[model samples]
Target: MDIDRRLKQLEDSIDENVIDVYDSNYLNIPIKLAYYEIDKYSELVRELNRIRYACKTYEEKELLIKDYIKIYLSSRKMYLRILRNLNNGAVKILYPDNLDEDILYRALKNFKKFDRGKPLNENLNTFMKVKLKQNIQDSNQELFKLKHYPAEYINTFKTYIGSKVLRYRNDLVIYKDAFISETEPHIYSVYFNEKTAEDTKNALLNILAYLNGHPSFYFTENYNFNRKLSELYDQFDLLDMLRLRKKFFFESKEYKEPIFLELPVLKQRCVLKIQITK
Candidate 1:
């Protein structure tokens, strides 16, 4: 199978609005590969066609089709992550108005219908609402706040992006009840792409840098303890690492807990483990 040609064709068909990688049912999983713009979608399709043409049996063609979608989904998510960083403002601006009303309705109205799914439609709406509202209600406030305490925004978005990456799943887990976790867990069990870990880490780093704050802190020579931590690029089990640290917290400032900073040391265990006791 000429995987490269198919990947290129798939990429060539992509467009910002025509086929929203974010909205597509096929591309919603955690993105493992970088997104291809519309120009590149054709390259992916060509490769897919090549694979189909080369397949000796129906099963092989089916396998190739599955692989093609899976890879494209992963790449799309990765692309979304890139946009999450490079175009945070744009994402923030367009999300609310451009939301797919049908999806939103299905998600909200048919909660009982899809038992294990992420309430994807619902989740999408909520994410957009929260992000857009924050951007809208406090555009100036966010700017002022970020300027005053850049780490707050940086830390906030980093956790959100990282958590999104970590929590991506192939199958949806549906529940009738609202979800809650009794245990505070930190985990980084995102499925790894066959692609280089460096690509994923670099994409993350790029997003981290653009999140309304100082990308410089990630490079502090004095904070060598947390600097780069390039080793984390290979650590596919970040979720487990996080869970072991037991220091994970929601990225909300309103929460009365501390979230993990993008520090390298926490990869092993919490360096400053704070215990609350009577």
Candidate 2:
């Protein structure tokens, strides 16, 4: 693709009215493109300085400068191709339908923010965190409606064990656990569960189905519970695990049993009967 032409197209797609000071929409070009442009310009400046330093004669310097200009332009086009390749890979995963306006801007912004120069999987994990936060916020109402289980049970369980399983739309069960303090809930676990050990895995299957079908469905790559549930789903071993009453401890420590401790909860306190003799 022609880099110059693509840049022109991107510029033309910007909505002037939406480009305000408060929001990032003012950035008519993708953030990645901006970075690329900056890098290319910097390279050009350095090459020009190098030519000036090397050539003593004006004519020789002119020739070198012209040659460097041509080289820079060629390299700029190559840089665009590189950007296109990176953008293409990101689009393949994100699957944004439109690249004309806000969607394009957001897509580029998201990719730029999440695309740490790392392995694809690592970049994907970063992207998922952003998407997950958005999904949770956007679908908050839908999720709240799915919480059919009594609030008493939810509250009590959360207080004691820092976990709550709520029924969602009768067909789905959502499990969320807070690994942090009970007073300040920070959910580290979120996934669907079967109603019973022998029950058909309809709820989880439905969620997977939903996610598969809905490209826009919010996702988090590093969701611990989701990963575990997905593994179980793949193996069809959720029922077996449930039947075995398998317990997972996110944190564990070995300590001596309390029998050796002198303090006992049930032991009565004895008061000395010696009256103060004045």
Candidate 3:
């Protein structure tokens, strides 16, 4: 936690590998202490600036600066804890030498949750979930209403709609075996199904069109890929109402429906309830 010690590590870091500390929570590891090895100095400066901006509402810059310093200090304590608990033999066999602080922090930050023997659900699995969670909570107030609905609905809907739209798209098999959950607040996630992409895409598009009186927001007869969605939505100037999935809905290129419009934002009942295949 000492600033001097962290500053020393940051100055010495110079490699590109992670160091997993198995004995504790992965993310809590102090990363700033090992910043010397982080490759892009520009990125560090950018991040620092962003953090600085976030703290700007405070009248005094001193308080804001202290907050950033605390973040770095806390990160270093974690790094040291990981180093202390590493298996003696595993450390020798895997690393064989001291690592620069930067490499150690980067490696640890990138550490897969699996490294700690946790289940896939415990792991973030992907950044998509993070983005999805943020969008849904920030945008879909109505859909979020369902979260407060009786659990019975959440537990039963997919079977309720299985034969119709929620059925399996890949085979004759139905999503009678599906289930749904919220990985993050407001993000209603059904177990991935054969028709998941289609079901979600259509449901969202239909809702958006119904609300906006547009021709069911579509590509300009040319846009093709999930990455272009923001551009296309912006081109049509629909970005204010559109959002990606795992937050409010799911998104996949294979699924004809790429964006799920948040109907709840208008404070209306959700046009469709999710069906989980069990």
lDDT of 3 by residue, 1-278 (tens): 24345545654562212333222433333332222122333344356556544542323323344434443443444334333433221221122233343433345465322234543222322322332233333323323322332121222223211101111232211233333433233323333333236566456445444333222333233335423653454444234233331353444344333444443222234453222211
Provide the lowest-lDDT 10-residue window in model 1.
173-182
lDDT of candidate 1 at residue 104, scale 0 to 100: 43
Candidate 1: Cα lDDT at 267: 21
Task: Give per-residue CA lDDT, model 1, range 19-77, as digits (tens).
Answer: 23343442332221122233353455565666565655434544554444545454544
lDDT (Cα, tens digit) per residue for candidate 2, span 1-278: 23345445544553322211123443543443322232333544465566555654434443443343343444444434433443444322322223344444465663556433565444543444354344334334333432433221122111111122222323332433111112223321222122222122234333332322211112245467655554544543222332234234224343323222122111125422211111
lDDT, candidate 2, equals 0.34
Model 2 ranges with Cα > 4 A deviation: 1-34, 38-41, 83-278
TM-score of each: 0.21, 0.19, 0.19
